[model samples]
Target: MESSSALALSQLPYYIYPTIPNTNKNYPFWPAGKRRSSQLPTRLHCNKMFVPGFGEASPEAKAAKNLHNFFTYIAVKIVAAQLESYNPEAYEELMEFVGRHPLNDGDKFCATMFRESSRHKNLALRIMEVRSSYCQNDFEWDNLKSLAFKMVTESNTRLMRDYISETSRAETEK
Candidate 1:
């Protein structure tokens, strides 16, 4: 009875994932068309791709790669900016890009600098730091000015949060 059952199970159509199909370069592996052919390897070739611990490259891997490249770009720009002479045009461009991205810390600091016109040293240092870390562009002079501006600008949320908290507390007390 066990043997019969085993045989029956074996006879049943089971799902199979073809490791590689033998067809031309363009076809769908197993010869879907005469004009088109595709190649599928039965086994993964290490020379072709090496996947270690994980089964496959995850989305996280892709993201990490992108982030790494972005940071590298920033670092190169920073070093170049610092070593080279001051250029107003480069600072402007950096500011425009930052304005578009509008990072909270970056934006706030930039705004402050623009208003106070202080912390030029801080701004320069940060510009180098940001570039060293993750900046990836041929920064413009205006953007550097903007970065300085953000350093000095007031945070809008600071006052708003305080007001809301004070009003709520008063209402509760009443």
Candidate 2:
């Protein structure tokens, strides 16, 4: 007697995404030797977890939660696929850890920013605005610099053309 939406949702893969392992702490909730465990209640609380929106939330809330989780999984999968074209190793690692794992929205944003160079600083900065919460300290600084270099040096994007020209002029003056 479930609604069509409910049926659709049931057909989609559902899993409690695991958080990436941190250097400092151990996650005790995922019982040893288990491939999947129920999602923990609060990301901060390792001990407390239950089926999301099962008993405590209203039907509307449950729908919303399901939608959010579904979309997050899709988005991460898309980004990981994009990484595969540019950096296969990074793509593999991201997929292995983040594809089915739980991460805050900020962490997802950071994952996309792992690119070697982007033509869009404004976009990158916009994503970075959320960086305060979930950046894992995993990005390579060299890649970031290379990204900036491409943005400025490439003919396509004009974000730093004037600045680069001015700097070159000053260097020549010296």
Best by TM-score: 2
Tell me how many residue pairs clash in candidate 1. 43
Worst 10 residues of 1 by lDDT: 37-46
Question: Which tens-of-lDDT digit does each residue in 1-174 have in candidate 1?
Answer: 322223333233445442333345543464443432223212322223333455466555865555544554455356447544685654664555455543434434345445544444455456546744454445454786797577556556677788999999999999
lDDT of each: 0.50, 0.50
Off by over 4 Å in 2: 1-56, 99-174
Candidate 2 lDDT score at position 138: 41
lDDT tens digits by residue: candidate 2, 1-174 = 222223333233346443523322355674555433342222232333334545778565875565444445455555556667987875666555555545555445455545524533333343344332223344355786798678767755564777789899999999
- Return the TM-score for each candidate structure: 0.21, 0.27
Q: Where does the lowest 10-residue lDDT sum fall in candidate 2?
A: 39-48
Q: Clashes in each model (backbone N, CA, C under 3 Å)?
A: 43, 3
lDDT of 1 at 129: 65
